[model samples]
Target: MGRYVRADGLDIWTEQVGTGPDVLLVGGLGDTVESWHFQLDGLADRYRLTAFDNRGAGRTAMPEDPVSIETMADDAAALLRALDIPSAHVAGFSGGSIISQELALRHPRLVRSLVLQSTWPVPDAYLRRWGLFIRWLAETAPAERTFLEGFYLDIYTPRAHNDGTVDRFIEDVLAFPHKQTTENLNRFLDAVLDHDTTNRLPDIDVPTLVLAGGRDSTSRPELGRAVADAIPGARFAVMEEEAHQPFQEIPDEWNARVDAFWRATQTRTT
Candidate 1:
């Protein structure tokens, strides 16, 4: 069953599966708990997997005020506290990874380990330009189809685009009627552009794993490397054939790597 927890004055929608050490999964910008559907059974057998919609996404209530990465991080921490979970292995994708970093930095004792996927410490000129383009598309596009087409172009590689996978994904996304509002999208984009955790990365003492997609044009592999390099003792790996959404593109490989990383950390701590 699913439930709601009050965090930062909003009702955050949350769900859990299986039973073991907790593994909190945070999805990317505009993503909901459904985005992690591919991961539930794969990891839940060995770990208690929890996934929640961020403040502005899915069933979570959005605050009228602007939100920051720090605020979102605090939401995650608060959710854990509400559930009586002392600490857990936290994994985040894209913008969610930024929040994961802040959660670890601000509440170090609550993060047992970290898995950052397709993440960057700060936005570069290329990323900033891409963000601007996305914003422009969101504002000026004539239809939702046009916007989604542009979005898919930016996120998926030729492997997905050439094989009709993009079409299926787009169809699925459009089927959701209560999509993110333009105001919330702008707020998220602003937060992502302003995110900078390079200086504080050295303070992250927990075991960390950074996964990158070599073919991802949106969040480049070099950006992932920068994150891994900044965090002391963080390991980095690249899935050459994937793009932004590796977990969806290749679930078995993605789940195996993450499961292995968590196991390694558990062994070390024990």
Candidate 2:
């Protein structure tokens, strides 16, 4: 069931379902618990899944302070503490993946395992340029739908656009009642662009997996490879034909891959 829970001074919208080892899902920029609906449904039989809206998005109101990836990571830690989950497999996508890194670093004991999806240690020149365009569009787009279309181009593959999947997402963004404020959206992107954890990956000692969309332009394969290389034992894999949001595009396949990894971690611990 969905409800609000106080964590890190924010009344976060959180949900938990199923029964078993805990698995916490973290969404990227502009996402909510609804972002993990497929995982909640597909993997719930074997895992107790939890998800929440990050501060500045969805039902969680933006804090008066500027959006920072470290604070967002702290929020994740606080939510898990609030929920009484000592530790759980943590999976984060895109911006969420960045936040997950901080969570694992700042509160290592709170994360049983780490799954970084469409992640990067730091943006290379290519992503830096793209980030600039994203910020400009977010600040200047004529309409919400227009901004969403521009923002999604690099996030999903051409196939999704051709098949109407992206258009549907555009509609959903337009209709969402709790929209992210323009100020927060830009600040959120700042946190993403300014983030640098290339030096800290080796500090994370937990079981780690880094997933990349082979066709993704936002956080490309090379960036993901660099992240995996930095983390001592982190494994890296790519969905060759998939783009950034494969969890949304091909959720069953994504779920299966992550499930297997999570199980492997349990076996090693046992």
Clash count of each predicted structure: 0, 0
Give a tens-digit lDDT track for model 2, residues 23-79: 999998888998898999999999999999988888888888877899999999999
How far in Å is the alpha carbon of 242 misplaced in model 1? 1.2
Candidate lDDT values, in order: 0.90, 0.92
User: Mind giving the per-residue lDDT tens digits that candidate 1 earns over 227-262?
Assistant: 999999999999998889889878899999999999
In candidate 2, list every pair of residues with a backbone clash.
none
Pairs that collide in candidate 1 are none
Highest lDDT scorer: 2
Q: Candidate 1 — worst ten consecutive residues by lDDT sum?
A: 1-10
Query: What's each prediction's TM-score?
Result: 0.97, 0.97
